[model samples]
Target: MENKTPIIALVDDDKVFQLTASRTIKAAQLTDKILQFENGEDALVFLKNHASDSETLPDYIFLDINMPYVDGWMFLEDYSLFKTKLSKPIEIYMVSSSIDPRDVDRARNNENVRQYIIKPVTREKFIELLGKAAA
Candidate 1:
């Protein structure tokens, strides 16, 4: 029997965070492919390009609030407009190093956001998230 792995998308400008998160996900045996984008613009482009294909759409998205072009908030705004056209539902999680109460409140208030996580996502968190995703 072949095990199917989930596709995870990481939208962040921090190269170190991407690398660390990718490694952590792999180490946790959560996912094999971690599609990375340096900014929300690139991630949005990818999503738009694959909107019609459910097989190509990401199962999970880890979005950072800050970036050079098209921050997470902007992406969310645009995504709200584009989501209705998509073939599948994407589970989005707001991940950032920011500990600001405003950010947490904002993420919590967003209907599309599943959860808010701090940076350096741990293996345990990945396992928990993966379990939830499977459910």
Candidate 2:
């Protein structure tokens, strides 16, 4: 059996958010590795480059809607092209601070999006998400 720890990717530009989210995920024992990306572009690059490698690709991606460049929307558009190329199925959760109903509707309409979560993701939320993913 393959002994690979699940990998989680946080695609956001906020430094403080990344730090806190990483800490919470670690504290919650969600996964062994957490990959941080400053923008969606970087995350997409890594995913594309490692599309054929299940062990190298992230199992889950928490995407933020706003950023300097290649925001979550753009990332979703681009990712749609390469989604089928991935060797492993990756669960994507659109995590944003926006309370806009449009944003929520858009995320929910997307077939690839597993769920949309608000900001300041709590340890309990992490547990629920991770547990559901495992199931």
Candidate 3:
């Protein structure tokens, strides 16, 4: 869906980080819808409704694990509920500053996840991931 164009979403509570990342994505000339959500619940709601009929369910989703309303794990669980519900695979990456081994393991083992990235994701890093996906 989404007119076959890439959709990039940033799910983070920090205003500074959100702004920085948004700017980075824009400056890179990736040129896509840079959607932002303060919490996982909000992102999940949009995903469940609008993206269900759409195909490009976030070509790249940067998800922050620590949030008040719904953490990243909770979001992942909520997202998993949509089994066979959509046409596109909403690729996800666990983006956070948490160093807890458990969180890393969980993200690594999750079937829907692509990778676990640290906070303040650099533009170069995201571009690298984008290259991987493109390749």
lDDT per residue, candidate 3, 60-100, as tens digits?
78899999899899998988888358667667988999989
Candidate 1 weakest ten by summed lDDT: 1-10
TM per candidate: 0.95, 0.96, 0.90
Q: Cα miss at 93, model 3 (Å)?
A: 0.6
What candidate 1 gets wrong by more than 4 Å, as runs, is 1-3
Local accuracy by lDDT, each model? 0.90, 0.93, 0.83
lDDT tens per residue, model 2, 14-103: 998899999999888777599999999999999999999988899999999998789999999999998999998999999999989999
Clash count of each predicted structure: 0, 0, 2
Residue 130 miss distance in model 1 (angstroms): 1.7
Candidate 2 — which residues are off by over 4 angstroms?
1-4
Q: What does the lDDT read for residue 111 in candidate 3?
A: 86
Q: Highest TM-score: which candidate?
A: 2
Q: List residue ranges in candidate 3 displaced over 4 A.
A: 1-4
Order the numbered candidates by lDDT, best leading. Answer: 2, 1, 3
| TM-score, cand. 3 vs. native | 0.90
Q: In what order do the candidates fall by TM-score, top score first? A: 2, 1, 3
